[model samples]
Target: MPTALAIAAFSPSVLLDVATTVRAADLRDWDIRTVPATSSPQVFGDLADGAVDAALTSPDNVLLYAGPADNPLGRMLDLVVPVTVDRGLDLSLWARPGLGALVDLDAPVLAVDVTASGYALAAFALLAQRGWTRDRLNVVSLGATPKRRAALIAGACDLTILNAGNELLAHAQGATRIASVDELGPYLGSVLCRSAHLDGERAGGVAAVGQALTATASEILAGEHDDLVTASAQRLLGLAPALADAYLTVLRSPAAGLVGDGRADPAAVRTLVDLRGASDLRRGVDVLSAAGIH
Candidate 1:
């Protein structure tokens, strides 16, 4: 057996399919390890602590690992290739049916997947658009998409940002989408990467992995993956067959978006940095240049 490689992922339709396909494939020196951690910190911790050889992560997190602020492990991680240029990873600001727009959310508490995650990114982006600051809301860290949805339905949150199947289910339960985060521009969701320390020796292997992911993307886009996609959704997310079908409907739809080349778009990076107002995420970056993504 080759080295066991752990790939962190979410429960979205596309990702579920990707994970299944990746696991089924017989890749060299890589006994596909699937680590199911949804938040940025948890994923990063696994990656930094050497628990995972590589992972599927966000572009923003890549930049943060390369940045110099509080991270003692800065510049140690690197993105080997991007899974896609666009994603269904849009954030939905949902409120109860009778509640007003996102602007009218007066609930005592708001929930996000994490303080520094896609949910927060989407929430803050929308708030900036509405001229509201973080201080205006009682923000709570709610773990993952499913948890956020549960909080919303239980009335534990006045508003919540949800993605993947949760957003669709929430809508069915009368949660109205008042605002969207994907519209904010350049929200790159998942990625495949190799650590900087191994890049020199494992470049070829990493590239091969990217090619495999591209193949998986093509297979799904060709519509030959309906069964695989649905099965994976049911396996990974525990979603009902009907709900899994709905999630796949959206994933294969134009709105789900896909980028098969595995290269991050520089424009996407700039947009994320600008949106977060944390341009310093790339303060001392130099390796991104070698990847030709910057």
Candidate 2:
């Protein structure tokens, strides 16, 4: 029997589908353990330390890898494939209605998950789209969606970036959606990858998992697995009747759901690269590869 491996995920929706397929195919028979987590940094750390075999992480991790700043692990890790287009709460720029456009927020405090989180990247992209430079905004690291929302409501921030169920709630509460990361286009949200150990020793299993994710995404896009999607929403997202339905609606849409090529959508790839380039997260290194049906 092979040893089990750890797999990190942020949301229940992402893990539910992959977990279901892994179980259904008896992936455990090959001696693999799946450990799901919410934090990307933790997952990345686990991957570097061999605590986890692979992870589903944002493209920002790629920026962390190919960077001008020093990364923890030098050159052992690489993204084997991008399994899904995670348009979920891709981060929306919001203000307290009548605050004028986002570009005018010169020195405005903007709430975010973290400086390195995907939400932050989206926020930067929003600023760029609004024709504002980095010096124009006072970026505040409020952490998590709940915190960001609280900051927004308590007037701790003039503007904020939110993701996931939080975005829906914010919109319902009258937070004006000045921009959506999706509007700028597709940026890489999550990916299927592993550390040097699994990348070398258990490459086949890793690829198998990626393949399963690709197939599941295809099924979702084709409406062949509506039950799986709904169940995933109910189980993982804890969404009520209305929100869950809406999420499913977006998930099934062409602009949001899985691409037909069993890889990332090209627009999303370009969006990510374009956004990253606009932001000062990296100096000049092209962080991600173009969309390919791996």
Candidate 3:
């Protein structure tokens, strides 16, 4: 029997992409697992508790978990980021049907995770760019993308950031994307985080995982797995064929999709630091190199 490789993540596409890549790599002996973590904290918790081997999370989480401060776990994790799944910002803030203008958004009561969540960090950055702050808006601590989507439709919140195939569904529902993380400088969106617990020959699996992810990314960038990817979008995200195609378009774009070579670039690292507004966290080339982000 093969060892189970479990990964905690948020986006449906990342899970699907990893599965596709793993299959393509002929790693039939490995039993892959994915848990859609309610929030970044949950993802980290799962990792710490030995419930999951690795995670697909942001660089901010990497820093905080491996840090000197601001970690929810209150301890440092020896995380190795060998590859980045999505190179671009897949997050987009969607508004209800009547909300066509930015100024029109009021109280806002935006539906997203707590201040520590990845969505909250990116949302805060966008809001700050618009001369707004987190204190000004009421952000609810919601978990899971489906709940957020339902909350938006039910008028529970004024806005929320949707990623991967979620944005496609939001578009189909007549909700408009008022803002995007794309406007912000290089967001290091999602990367492959591996546990340092594995030793000897077991540790080699991390490199295999990275190579599989890189292969998948190359297929996505080259549009080689359109049917498979589109089918995945439909099944995993409940997206229609047209919406799946739209998601595929984003996935295939050289600017908006996965990292082709599996290495996390330094510029994206700098952007992630700026996006989190954590300049004092001892971030730079050296830190990234130490974290296996290069």
Candidate 4:
């Protein structure tokens, strides 16, 4: 049976990396049923329930679900990360183009789902850096990057964070990036994770996918095969030529890309934990290791 892979964002940041890595592994025959990125609950919950073999999601989801305090599902299931997708934070805070400066940004609304999303936590940190409180902007709970992107473009919300193909699309639409998570330093973005309950063929499939993802990260970091990268972004994320180009430019840069060895940076993971106000969670390191990254 083909391994079922659910993606939270389903963008090139993921699709291209998977495709390149799988191709490098010569696992072309590997059948993977792709479920589009949706709300984290629906996707990660499926993994927790064993409905899906594995998924690509933020480390925040993994930690939140693994933790004792906020795990809504009651019983905590081990979310094993087989590979790390992005080592550095690949997010940008964008707003309507008309604003002259960050001060002119009277953005009364910040469109992001604060419910169980690490990006939302990072958004709050960015706001603090700018001397603004969470109350400064009315946070709108919206799932999926495209929905958030649309909200920012339509001025439904004055600001939101975007990454990968979504960031390029937002930029092309005149949503200017005012601040980036990169500036904040070391934010773990995404990972390929699975439940500890997986075994037999399921476990083998997870390993294969992890190997492919690791290979994909290596190729991306090497920054070769521009055409392949661009095509994958366009096909998977439905980005226009210009947007695809922009995505590639960023992907090839040293600022951000895949985590070449699938090992999650401890500092980066720690940064996320601190941002989420879960610093006292001592077992976090063990949890991060269970995800196959440390």
Report lDDT per candidate. 0.62, 0.60, 0.69, 0.70
Can you give the lDDT of residue 10 in candidate 4? 39
Ranking by TM-score: 3, 4, 1, 2
Query: What does the lDDT read for residue 54 in candidate 4?
Result: 77
Per-residue C-alpha lDDT of model 1 across residues 43-149, encoded as one tens digit per residue:
67676666665666656666666564554333345444424433544446787545566565553467876666645777877766776678778888877677778
Sorted on lDDT, best first, the list reads 4, 3, 1, 2
Candidate 3 clashing pairs, residues 3+ apart or interchain: none
254, model 2: CA deviation in Å? 1.6
Kindly give the number of clashing pairs for every candidate: 1, 6, 0, 1
Whole-structure CA lDDT of model 2: 0.60
Estimate, for each residue in 128-183, the C-alpha lDDT of model 4 and write its tens digit.
89887887777888877777888888878888887867777777788888788877
What is the lDDT, from 0 to 100, of the residue 43 in candidate 1?
A: 69
Model 2 — which ten-residue stretch has the worst lDDT?
283-292
- Candidate 3 positional error at 265, Å: 2.2
Predicted structure 4: clash tally: 1
Identify the candidate with maximal lDDT: 4
**Deviation from native of the Cα of residue 22 in model 2, angstroms:** 8.3
- Candidate achieving higher lDDT, 1 or 4: 4
What ranges in model 2 sit over 4 Å off? 1-3, 18-23, 30-41, 67-79, 82-84, 87-90, 96-106, 143-158, 199-202, 278-294
Per-residue error for 265 in candidate 2, Å, reads 3.9
Cand. 3 TM to true fold = 0.89
Between candidates 2 and 4, the one scoring higher on lDDT is: 4
| TM-score, cand. 4 vs. native | 0.88
Candidate 2 global TM-score: 0.75
